[model samples]
Target: MNKYILNKQQKLTTEKIRNLADSIGIDALGFADASEFTGYTIRNSRRRDPKLSLPEAETIIVAGFYIGGLTLPAWSNFLYGRTSRLYLSGFFLDVVKPLESIAAFLREKGYHAVVCDSSDSERSVLPLKRAAVRAGLGWQGKNSLLLSKKYGSFMALGGIITDAVLEHNTEEEPDRCGSCSRCQEACPLHALEQPHVLKRDTCLSNFLQIEYFPENAQSVSENRVGDCEICQDVCPWNRKHLENPLKTHMTALFQQKIHYWEDIFYLPNLIKMTEEEYESIFKDLNTGIPYSIFHRNVFLAMERAKKS
Candidate 1:
């Protein structure tokens, strides 16, 4: 086949992938060249180069799932230990399924494909936020989260590394977070002192994942038992989402059982919950919190509740 014919065929295949992603309910999609990321330091060379993840990688398919509806104001009662929208919506694990479907489609087309791990950034082969920006999905916000005009920081990102020569997004999303400092100021631990950067050591969201949080984390983690989204909550781009959040297929299902979740996550009830009950309630979701650590967080929240 001639080079022109081969290029046209690749473009057609890329279109098919986009349609499939939409049909599968990916809220946002973008394609980027699988090249070494040089705009920032990733420390890990393997993560900075897509070729390391998939030797023949020529394109990266980035997908975003909106979970704004899950972050709505109703779930913030101090009497209950709360989890982030990202957590309650099961996005950590839910994102893998759609990306895998896309990967499978590429593999069937005689292309090598790899789906990045969705549970943690460290586990992911690509620096997903940077890749998302290059893919034109969004720009990095002051809080170090991907921020889109529509979705803000309410997106759960996932992607597939593929050897297919897909049509790449020519333009990167320009930084729209100009002059916005709300996310930095909103951080209880001042983790975002540097714009578009985060100090993971002082980040409350990071602390919650570990067994022991510091003394300062106690006061700020008043009602939170899992992840924290205060920085995201204060982003000006997220104001619309906060006012009228968008509902995804996954979050819509979670909404139906909000009351049930509220009952179970009530700080007092969580403090008294047995191991079996904990497993039953959280088994399907990919929340990383163990029963013991979860109970400890609940105790901390209950202590703050008493003070309040």
Candidate 2:
């Protein structure tokens, strides 16, 4: 094919992919030059190199799905940690699955495609938040989260890397968090050091999600079992959208009522279960968070309750 014809075909294919993503409920979709993120570092020594995940990657297609901001209210319910799990589960179904489908579609078209989820821990996978920003989907908020003007910071991100040289969207979202420090002040553990900078070690959410709680975090690791949303909750962007009523249409699988931390920790079967058994019960909550970590958090919450 002539160079001009090839370029036109590629643009058409890219548009088709974007249209398909929108049809599948992806709130935002954009293509970024994979090479632009070749040396993007997320933090200390964590560089985002697309080539690591997909050697043939030429373009990165980033997508975002709105995870309704209203879910925060339910997260405030200390007795049941259902909101975060529900949001994550929905993210897999809504964001990850669609990205996988997009990759499959690209592969069917004879392009080398690889899907990357936000939960992926592999070093090769570029940070989806940065990729999204590069694609003009949103900007990184003060809380270190991708904040979209349309969806705020409540959106979940997923992406696909393909060798196809699609029409790219390089428009970057300018930082809109000018002089706002709500997230920094809201962190109970003082995790936010400054705008766009975070102390992961001191973050309660990080401690609760890991298998073993750090000795230094034992004091504040109580009452929360999994993800923490305090920083996002206090963000002006999130608060603006949360003013609307919550959309309770989403399903929560493990919604069994529990009045207190003891209700979860003292259950006869729960107390006697082996690590493997305990893991099986909460395995679906967040694949990134191991059952042992959650179990440990429960114990901490129980101890805190007892002391109080």
Backbone clash numbers for all candidates listed: 0, 0
Off by over 4 Å in 2: 1-6, 42-47, 69-74, 82-87, 90-95, 211-216, 245-281, 306-308
Best by lDDT: 1
Provide the overall lDDT of each model, using Cα atoms, as 2-decimal numbers.
Answer: 0.82, 0.66
- Give the C-alpha lDDT of model 1: 0.82
Q: How do the predictions measure up, each by TM-score?
A: 0.93, 0.79
Residue lDDT tens for model 1, 1-308: 11232477887898899899889989999988888898657555577888888888888889998888875343567887878878876766546766787888888988898888666555578788998998999998889999999898999898888888888887887888888798898898999999988898899888888876999887788788888889987888999888877767866876788777777777777898998888888977767677888888888888888888
lDDT of 2 by residue, 102-134 (tens): 888888889998777565355236578888888
> Model 1 reaches what TM-score against the true structure?
0.93
